[model samples]
Target: MPTVLVIDDEDMVRLVLRQFLERQSMTVVEAEDGEEGLRLLRANAVDLVICDLIMPRADGIGTIMNIRRLMPAMKIIAISGGGRSHAMELLKVAEQMGADHVLGKPFTRDQLLAVVARCLPGHPMTVRSSARSG
Candidate 1:
């Protein structure tokens, strides 16, 4: 199974993502902030990253930039719940900074799975779902 790193400050959000991804048979690792997320990424091999935008201790943009600089091949999905306006802005920034995909918060489990599928092609687990109900 491919490894995925999830970075979010909120415990509930992290739990939701971890549970959903694990259900897809992906190995899940977590960090409360971008700093710890980056540290884990450097120390271990992570196939995908799902990061939140407003986290303390480095923020999602910084994490994405740094990760792109150090490991451009690493796939990243930037996620934000900072309302629709803020989330759109963050999504644009994430794209500019090299994130593979950007998702708004309150996303469905299937939406998350779809973005992962688009970003990580070779991993069969990432290919398992779509944003729309099947």
Candidate 2:
């Protein structure tokens, strides 16, 4: 199974994402911030990273840049629920910095699944009913 690293500061976001990704038959690993995320990346062989922007330590942009330098082939999905109006702008910068895909907050299960599928084509596409539950 493909392992996915989910880096977010919010507990609920991490729980929700973990449930969804696990339902898709992927192994889910989580970190509370970019700093922890980077540590996890160095320790584990992850297939993809779902990172939240605007985090407390080492924000997503820095994480992306470092990931690009360290693991150029790793796939990244940058996510942000911006504090102000610049969420899109930050996401754009993340893409430019090397995130393979970007997701805005409040995204649906289908959207997340679609992006995951696109990023890791060899992974199975089965969607469990639990993934659609609240």
Candidate 3:
């Protein structure tokens, strides 16, 4: 199974993402911030990273840059519910910085699954029944 690292400051966001990704048959790892995410990346062989743009310690852009430098082959999906009006701008910057995909907040489970499948083509798409109702 492909392992995905989820980086976000919000507990609920991480929990929701973990549940959803796990349902798709992917291994999930959680990190509270970009710094922790980077640490986990170094410690584990992560196939992809789903990162929040606005975060404490280290932001998504910086983390994405570092990840690109460290693992250019690794796929990244940048996500953010923008605090400011420039949330889309930041996501665009993330893409420029090396995020393979970008997702805005309030995205549906289907959207998440689609992006993951696109990024990790080798992984099979496995959707549980609960995920469809949620």
List, residue by residue over 80-133, the lDDT tens digit for candidate 3: 874567888888889889988888887888878878887889888863322111
- Which residues of candidate 3, in runs, are more than 4 Å off? 126-134
Span of 10 residues, lowest total lDDT, candidate 2: 125-134
Better of 1 and 2 by TM-score: 2
All candidates' TM-scores?
0.90, 0.91, 0.91
Q: Compared with the true structure, what per-residue lDDT tens digits does model 2 show for residues 19-125?
A: 98898889999999888998999999899999988888679899889988999899999998745578888888898999988888878888788788878999987
- The Cα error of candidate 2 at residue 109, in Å, is 0.5
- Which one wins by lDDT: 1 or 3? 3
**Model 3: lDDT to the true structure:** 0.86
Model 1 lDDT per residue over 1-134, tens place: 88999999999999999998888888999999988998999888899999888887688999999999999888898898756456777778888888888888788888988888777777666444566311
The TM-score obtained by model 1 is: 0.90
lDDT of 2: 0.86
